[model samples]
Target chain A: MAKGGKTLGEEALQQVARRFAVLGEPMRLRILQSLMDGELPVNSLVEATGGTQTNVSRHLQTLAAAGLVARRREGAQVFYSVADPSIFELCELVCGGIRKSLAAQAGSLR
Target chain B: MAKGGKTLGEEALQQVARRFAVLGEPMRLRILQSLMDGELPVNSLVEATGGTQTNVSRHLQTLAAAGLVARRREGAQVFYSVADPSIFELCELVCGGIRKSLAAQAGSLR
Candidate 1:
């Protein structure tokens, strides 16, 4: 935090905030999640995410731009999957964190 | 993905999407970034995150509810930090993914 005897202050937080903003969209998250199940075609993604083909494609583009998802073209079809395995780790960690909070809350309630 | 030999369909992605939705807020991201810097007191968090005291307080509660953050009280002040170190891993992985994407883009451009 200290910089030139003071602080870099807010911009540091803002940079990280932008990353979160990129991931904040529901459609994008669904696209990432679908990728986790396995590499999926864009049409498959649309059906799996319950989003329109146009919306699903748009979200996939957003996700690809963010580096959360990647696509591979084989012949005429492109399959998309989580760009890095670490994303699964993020999902698991967040899921586990949620479980832990629920347990703590139940304990407090009791 | 399988329900009765086919698929659980879309609900699976929706659950994960909601979780991502909770984490996608910028102020929330800033709060988490501050926690990553280290556990911080509420007043310090307000300063570090550049958010109103009331807003910081509200965001912390939302984070607590999401299980992405936890608070410990020492004396009269509450300190908040990432509930799971895994969140840091998420940040790092996502950041790394971004770097990789940039590198790929550069390579392609070249």
Candidate 2:
């Protein structure tokens, strides 16, 4: 995105930082990873992440507030799915960056 | 890139989370944005980011510790530059994601 070519204003910068902050938690990332395949109910997410129902639900709320995940209700059950497909790409970029950083560190150690 | 296809183990997940958490701070992001073009001395970053020398230096230390920025000592002055070019791409992806999210919200409102 050429958007990176220009400097971001304060508000926009904060928005960007907020998104990163939202994804910074270990449990939050775990929950997102659990939903990588598709949508799942709260119970499934709880099982998939090995988090308690309450903890999973709390993270879901945070993710929903960030607009990174979508929520749906069917009867008494709640289902959640990734609202933004770009999220996977974001994670991919971070992983790639980490790998490069590690490789650089190893090279420096040599 | 394809690394995102596999689930990250606990240690790796924490590392990823740590990277994200480091980027979460507004002041740190500001410092990074200031250095986006090229390397600069501490004084120049202070002027560009409008942060005090102490504040800018602190953020630089955080960025350096995260291995996101590189530091060099030229004579008595310290210079900093982006250690990872992937950082630009990461911010670009994030900006794109935020644009899409805002667009979706606008559509919902319409």
Candidate 3:
């Protein structure tokens, strides 16, 4: 259930899960990280992520399909950028959690 | 690569992806949501999520393994609670992204 006494609709819950699932791929995350500074063409993403053009293109399609990225064309080059900037904050929150979890584990070893 | 020109190790990237993958299941999300209020025993979680005892137990084990939830035993009952509260923030961020995506889709449709 969400705020108040109403339960989150099943569809909404599934959508949220799907969003997480889309972000679960390391290649996708790498592509997003590369685009953090600004929009970059597919070739640039391939170079930045050290991934093949085919692999980077595949992940870019996945991110665009998830609405996490937007694609544009400037002449012959196709560029991708973070459509949802909130993703950076999401990564930050997860990173913070990971840091805390690691700290707890380290403390437990002492 | 992260800020300061240091690239995140492959292991760290995989860990982050794993964390997101663990949250990708709707049933797991449901289990976490049920525990949002506080700790609950397996029986209570089974009821709250409307999942069978065996299923809820399995999800709880997965959650615990991920260090997303903590396990406690008292007398004859084992209880579970959120070990990482930052998950709620993560969910909120994903939910916000979904809402934005949906709104944009709706706007484009109109």
Question: Arrange candidates by lDDT, highest first: which order?
Answer: 2, 3, 1
- Please write out the lDDT profile of model 1 over residues B2-108, one tens digit for every residue: 55422223564454555556666768777776777688899998997778999999989987877778789999999988876666665665555555666777887
Ranking 2 against 3 by TM-score, winner: 2
- For residue B35, model 1's alpha carbon misses the true position, in angstroms, by 2.9
Fnat value of model 3 = 0.72
Against the true structure, what is each candidate's TM-score? 0.72, 0.94, 0.91
Cα shift from native, residue A36, model 3 (Å)? 0.2
TM-score leaderboard ranking: 2, 3, 1
TM match of model 1 to true structure:
0.72
Error of 1 at A80 (Å): 3.6
- TM accuracy, model 3: 0.91
Which fraction of the native contacts appears in each prediction? Answer: 0.40, 0.80, 0.72
Q: Residue A85's C-alpha lDDT in candidate 1? A: 68
lDDT of 1 at B68: 73
Candidate 2: stretches off by over 4 Å: A1-5, B1-4
Instruction: Quantify all predictions' global Cα lDDT against the true fold.
Output: 0.69, 0.89, 0.88
Q: What are the RMSD figures for all models against the true structure? A: 5.0, 2.4, 2.5
Pairs in clash, predicted candidate 2: none
**Model 3 regions more than 4 Å off:** A1-7, B1-7
